[model samples]
Target: MATPSSPFSFLDDLFNRIGERLQPPAWAVHEIQHRAVLFLNHVLQQEPEAQQRLLRQQGRVVRFQWRFVTMEMVATPAGLLDLAPAGSVPELTLTVTDESPFELARATLRGGKPSVQIIGDVQLAAEVNWLVDHVRWDVEDDLARLVGDVPAHTIANGARRVVDALRQFVGGRKPPQAGGPSTGSASTAE
Candidate 1:
C-alpha cells in the first residue's frame, strides 16, 4: 500500500523561507526575552533545589541560540535568572542544532529533547544540564489557583490525554499500556 502524501509538506519550506527573510524587531525580541525570563523565574520559584543550584552558578552568563534567535541570561545571587546585558560575554553557550520547526514540534510532542551543541565552561554546562533534567513547570498547580483543585485536575487530565494522542500520531507508535504488549508497529506478516 502506498502512503499518502501530506498536503502541508510545502509548509516547512515556506516557514524556512519566511524565517530566513524576516527577523523580529529588536524591541519585540527584547520583550520576548524578558517574558521568557519571567516565566523561567516563576517555574524556578516552585523548585527550591533548582533555585539553590542556580545560585551556585550566580553571575555566570549562559547564551542560548536557536536559529536566528539568541538570548543571554545570568543566574542572580538571589537564585533567580535575569537577562544579561547586551554584549555581556557568556561563560557557556548552548546552540540548538535542529533547524526545522516541524521537527522540533514533533520531538516536543513525543517528549524528546532537541539536539543541542554545548560549548564553554564544563561546570556551568553541568549545572544547566541538571536544571534541565529536573525543573518543570507545574501548569496544573497554577491553574488550580485560579479555578480550584478539581477543575484543574480534570483539565490537566484531559490535556494529558490529548497530548498523548498527539504524541502517538507524531511518533507513529502507540505507547504500550501497563503490562500490555505493543501493537504499535506495522503488522509483522506484512
Candidate 2:
C-alpha cells in the first residue's frame, strides 16, 4: 500500500520550484543592490563612528551574498557605499550560511544575528562585525519624519508588540520578564 503524501512537503516543493523559476532580471538585481547600498549608507550616516570606520576602509570592496543574490560594494572616502562593478574583485566576502529564509526572517524579527561565513581579510571582517553590532536603522525616526511623532511612536510600539508575539510563537517560549532571567523549562514548586 502507498502512503499518503504530506501537504506540507508538496507545498515546500512547489514553493522551491516557483522561486527557481522567478529569478529576477539583471537590471532589477542591480537596482535592488543600489537601493540596499543607499539604505546602508543612510544608517551609517547616523553613526559618525561607523562612517569613520568605513572611511578608513575606503576603496575596499566587500561582496555580500545570500543564496543566488550577490552585491559588491566599495567603501568611499565620504564614508558612503557605492555599488562596485560586477567584475571587480572583492577584498572581503560575506555569505549568509543559513539556507532557510524563514529562519533568517525569524531571527531578524527577534533582533538576533543571522549566521554568515566570512572569507578574505580579517581586518575587513572585524570592521564589518563592528558595523553590524553598532549600526541600526532608526525606523521610528524615519517614520516620525514622514508622519507625526505620536503616530510614529504608536506604530513603532505596535510593531514591537507584533515582533514579540512572532518571536514567542516561533521560539515556543515567552519573552523574558523585565529585570528577570529566562527559564526555558516549565517548573512549579508547591
- Local accuracy of candidate 2 as per-residue lDDT tens digits, 89-171: 99999999876566677788767899999999999999999999989898999999999899999999999898889888877
Candidate 2 CA-lDDT value: 0.87
Stretches of candidate 2 exceeding 4 Å from the true structure: 1-12, 177-190
List the candidates' TM-scores in order: 0.87, 0.84
Question: Per-residue alpha-carbon lDDT of model 1 for 60-94, expressed as tens digits?
Answer: 99999998889999999999999998889999999
Q: By summed lDDT, which 10 consecutive residues of candidate 2 come out lowest? A: 3-12
Cα-based lDDT for every prediction: 0.91, 0.87
Angstrom error of the Cα, residue 160, model 1: value is: 0.5
Best by lDDT: 1
With a 3 Å backbone cut-off (N, CA, C), the pairs that clash in candidate 1 are: none
Q: How many backbone clashes does candidate 2 have?
A: 0
